[model samples]
Target chain A: MKCYYHPDREAVAVCSVCGKPLCAECAQEYKGKVYCKECLAKVKEEEEVAASKSNVSKGDASKSGASEGVVPKSAVSEHTETSSTESKAKKEVPYKGASTAKVVFTSIVVALVIIGLILLSTMGISGVLTPLSLVTSKSSSVESVTAIPYEGERSITVSLDANNCMLNVKELENAIDDKVVKENTEGAKLAVLTSVNTASRMSYKNGTLTVKATGLKKNAVVNLYLTIRIKEVSLESDVKNASFSISLPDIPISAKLSLTNGGISLSNCTVDRINGTIMNGSVTIKNSGVTGIYLKGMNSQISFSDNKFLGNVSLNLLNGTLDVKGNKHIASFYEKGVNSVINCDFSKTEPPMSATFKNITTEVTINVGKQPAVISAPYADVKADSYFTVNGSNYTTPNYSKQYSCLDISVLPAGETAIPLGSITLLGGD
Target chain B: MSDIDARYMLGSILLSLGIVYILSNVTANFSPFWGFIGIFLIFEGSYYTVKYVFRQHKDITNPLVTLFLGIAVLIFTFHIVIPTFTMLVAGFSIAVGAALLLSGFVFKISRKEVLSGLILIGFGFLIATPAVFNISEKFYRYLHIYGVGALLILLGLVLMIPRNKKSVKKDEGGKSDEVH
Candidate 1:
């Protein structure tokens, strides 16, 4: 039979309420009864109207009984029970027809909202729908070099600000003979090599070489080959191929470096002091010597290997790893942060190195040298080797004496009322 | 408000307070963003709990799911055991997917729920297994960003399409006459 709603379509079912021949699109099943859309709406409206009339009558009867002072609590209970049952039944109606349409509309809206949120979070407010350009092989390469002559300056200060690029700072093997510098001139040089997609600036003034590079947007598509190569080493690939190589004269200079979403490598450099702040990157300092060191990092992997600090070393980390390996020596070391893993091998370190750790939920491993060490960790769960004598909140090596040069180690809570949820492992070495 | 709703609200308030106190004491730097998310989950969990307890909802699945998600978020904020954010998300996804799949089999839910459960399980595995097995990151990113959204759109479209209904007389062995 032809359908009621669409005459050209074949009828699939007959509405139980009105006996209308219904197409699939116009038929709805409710309480095991197939009804046409119109019949279903009409029946529901009629039932609601009847229910309202019955409720009105009940209200009138209750009022009349209350006025006559003969109302019964049992009747009120029964009335409430029946109303609740009706409400429950009404709530059991599954989504059908118009309600299903509403769900689809809502889903589309939600999908759009989710897409918008992702764009906003990854791409920021500007350039929401810009085409992805990070991965394109057609982008041109841009290179810039800046050289600063050493004009009787005893100490040079190097400052760098970079984003989404690899930064390397190394002592010039030939301080004056580098091709980037003049033959007779002896100075530092800053060379920035990057893609056209990124923006970089370099300036040298008053004994400081300042270099800045901004990376591409976070959500930009990356080249598959480059991404795979970088991702294997756990590096961000949105910058395509960008790097800043700074060659400094082998002198006692100081450095101040800041990075966002990039890696920093400082090797074979001598500095009076070094201060660095990195967000979302890895830091590697190998075979470097400095008088003092201060670093703050978030979501970064910081490592110091074969480095010597004549002064103090202060590190603050959040949500990352810190590894101090090889022959590392510091006059004093202080670390403060949360949710990080720290591994320090001070077996080859010089004596009289005072180290203090204040953190929360950070796993710490320290290997003590031949020097006698007195370790105090009140907040941390300390696991010490058998070579140490255990006192209350203190672990002391058998060779600990008041007159000897000792390593003073202390682990305390980062803040008041903060519970330390991490463990500390102390390994004794000869 | 009904008695059950009032009690649920009170319970939610107390639970939020407890979470705040614990988070403040446990984490060195307590992030407000994750804190708000945890509280939001707690409220949702309490709402579903009330629905299940008062017989307003027919099944315990929703309450259990919400409760697990809420607790997991709270624990993530603490940042004690879980090492990285990616691992936390992967673990949570895998756990929720497993829960959904189990509930689908045990409760005999609708076909849509079953499909959704299977999809979530697949996504969870896709996200978690890649790091261990050295899967390509570009492929993972594409799948994570576009594939999930496309699936959601497809699901919506599928739900919008109308299905053919069976003849009542044939299905019920000539029950149309009785109804008439």
Candidate 2:
């Protein structure tokens, strides 16, 4: 038989709906049944029409039954069954897998977005807040030089109060010489040179010259020089990095210095009394003489080299150290502290100089050279060299006598909590 | 899957991406990609647990395991001092492992959960003494990277796995018929 759709080809099978012979090319297979293409299309259309009719009839019947208050049970059941079947078919469909190319593309996009956000948060915030001028600013300094005349004053007090600054003060004879004095008809000209990033005020009133500088730029240096024809000078500074050099006339002058968070250097001065207090810095005194000296320090180092003290000298320390070197002539020295250290070489010191130490957890080392010194540490852990005679807590030299001119050293307890005293080393030069 | 599950999965992905974006902007030290993913997983697992509590589902073991795994990954991604980080990891691991073990043995949850609980307990002990094992920072970094990467790939594969919709429909129909 000739094929229904393809007449030139031989018939291979019969259409399931129409019973027409069909070739393979003109046939369609569905659910184990083969049909001609035209028959298959017609059959699908007819099924769709029948499904529409059934749905229409069900909807009409339900509406009529609802209006009459008597719904058909079979209609409801059929409707539910159809919906359930449809939902099951929907649920049964497998989800397609996402392609690798798409995932890679998404990841790249996400990474780019993250990087952009990071950059914006880090750099954009700063860019928005900082001023344009401040971004390219440079450091520059300002200098101001002034000369104040010194009148015929026997004693002058110089006071400086500064913050975050370096101060240099010097006393020179030739600074206010005849030429400078004659040049300025007012008084002895005091040369003051100040270099800082901020403004500083200097006023000379009565017998006191006060220099005050606050809110200076970080790491600023201020220099001040004074040359006066005065006998006594009392210099007091509550500044940082202060260096003072004073020369004594025939009559010595007294110096009073105070600092915080800075160092103090005092050289070549003869004073009746030297009083200094420092916190968190060091104090260096060289080539100076004082009738009486008092120094109090905390977290500081106080060193005295080539200094003569004729009267009583007192040192109070807390977490600090004291070093005395090079021919110190201290007639009487008293030190009291906690967690401090005292290293005194009485080798070049004059005889009859006495030192009393009242310390807690303080290390004391004394070198008495050819000076018959009587060392006494009642509660201290004493470690004496062989040159000294250790008699219990008292260490004494062979030639030591109470009546003779000898060095007397004593180490006593500092506070009530001084359960165990610090170490004490006594050395005698044979 | 139901519409709710699809919505939750999409929400998890979006929330994780958002967290990554925010963390990238907030810090420059390390990427928080894996940490955010773990957080999303924890949130998703909590949602599942809530649904189960409301009698919307029958299973509980899968959600519990996912919650524990999320916590583990979150702890692993933390960048802190070695001692503190290790202690946190060990403490969390031991706590979760103990809880899982109790549920699996006493409450009779599932064999898979019991095995995972034991494994977590072992891991906790191992992590407790990092000095004994000499675990270096480099090793930890590599582990974090690769572990998180593998988790991501696994998540993708699971999401991409084809569901036999016909079998699922048949099962549901059978259940409904039995109910009827």
Candidate 3:
């Protein structure tokens, strides 16, 4: 084969399938017109109706562009006679191919969607989201918080009508290195401003830190942190206890937090594991993705809004209740107790999670799909009723172990009432 | 076959091979028969692609179709491959840690994402961490029904409910209202 670089003569080559003189510069390639210059242009003017056409029902849009200007009037010769029905059927093909092309694109998008779902489930969605730090102002005070930010020291500002500044932690450390990040500061120059009035007071140990400030004046600010590896850090404030405001950036880790007394708030926090207690305080968790989580409280009801969950989740109540609304679901739940009530609408959830409960003193009314998958408590008493509901498959655990179905029954002799949980066996599975 | 065509075919073949290989790796339960099936499909795809470009320089199979199938195959592989691959990555990360420990300042120059870098390191630990719990009371509340219903359903009703009881508005003042 001699090379003809942009020659005027139509470059021809042998077709691989049928040894025909195929014109390069106008050769048919891909699924389109890639032919000799002149013939390629001609092919463009008139697509081979016979070649691309297949048997599919199509309207008469074919005669528009190509056929009219395609074949030279003098060269109006038809070759390779096709069956009349075949030809008609063939005419439908190019259009079918066009439709098929669209379907192929759709299939691609769908495949991508399915793959994305798989990846999300397995790889664990990136804990990466905007920091949950938010500045909000009420009549006199505002609060903001973040969890698992950077490993080093971080600072945040809060609004309250108490002390000018409160120290959250005097010493903080990185879990990996156990490096001392923050330390004691006597009369440390704190930011001027805010509600409460108190001098900076702090004490630190291996993994615990204590900061105290009372009589907070308006416009004061306090900085908070895990303080240490956060072995067990508790933020509880009474009427006189100084309020702590936390702030940090998004950390790609999971955390289990417990709260009592004062309000605990956090934003943009993602967790893989958690079991928390809230009593006599409000817990506000936002933008957090959890695999398995539980929040239980009495007297002080806990509510979660704008939360995302991935796996098994449940809330039990002996006195107060729990409420949550957001974009996620429970794998399953099992509940039991009197006066304790379980209510959930499974239709709003993504996964098909359900619950089973032996409502002793519980009044359970949870919604799954359209029907209410609820079971009521036996006692139905106001005082001793316990109610529980969760999103997970039921499994019979060790007969002695307390099957989470009972909300208020803590004193029962251990027997064979264990519920086996087996649906989500994966690490992140509920 | 045109060099450009052959190169395109090669690229597609490589991509398809990657998908096939990944699929092979992740399957929890794999049979030699399925492996052969996957191999055959990939090889068949590659073979036709090469032959088309080399012999005829025209693709007989639709590229879009082939691309879709390849992606599906890759996803199938990802589901199977990642769990095992996680270990490999974990080991590699440990090695990197060792290297970093040894070559501290040397690696500091890649300060491009040092903040993110530290967070990621912690996150890796987080991924391996077991959950923690504290003494707790438990309550379950799905109280948004009233709010959601009020905002969504009742709001819709309110929006649809006209403020005007029976008064014809200025725009509604028609040409003729006289009854014969």
Candidate 1 vs 2: which has more lDDT: 2
Predicted model with the maximum lDDT: 2
Question: TM-score of each candidate?
Answer: 0.31, 0.33, 0.29
- Per-residue lDDT value at B131 in model 1: 44
lDDT of 1 by residue, A1-430 (tens): 9887687899999989667788998889987899977567656655755765676576687778745454457756656766665565456654245543343344334333432343344334212122111111111111112322233322212222322222221122122124324222235344443332344444333333334434423322222111100101111122211222222335444545444455556666665666766668676777777677787777888888887554688887777798887755677887775556778776666655667765334346776634344464444422232232332234435443323222347323234222222323633321
lDDT per residue as tens, model 3, A2-93: 21333335546643433345545435674542333333433333454434243111212334553434443333223233344345544543
**Per-residue lDDT of B104-157 in model 3, one digit per residue for the tens?**
324234343344435444544433222112111121122333546656887799
TM-score of chain B of each: 0.56, 0.54, 0.24
Please compute DockQ, using alpha carbons, for every candidate against the native two-chain complex. 0.03, 0.03, 0.03
Instruction: State the TM-score of candidate 3 restricted to chain B.
Output: 0.24
- How far in Å is the alpha carbon of A327 misplaced in model 1? 6.6
Give candidate 2's error at residue A167 in angstroms: 8.2
Instruction: Give model 1's clash tally.
Output: 0
Question: What would the per-residue lDDT of candidate 2 be over residues A161-201, giving only the tens digit for each residue?
Answer: 33223233222323234443343334533333232334555
Off by over 4 Å in 3: A1-168, A173-249, A252-260, A332-338, A356-363, A370-430, B1-180
Q: Count clashing residue pairs per candidate.
A: 0, 2, 84
What TM-score would you give candidate 2 relative to the actual structure? 0.33
* Model 3, residue A256: C-alpha shift (Å): 6.3
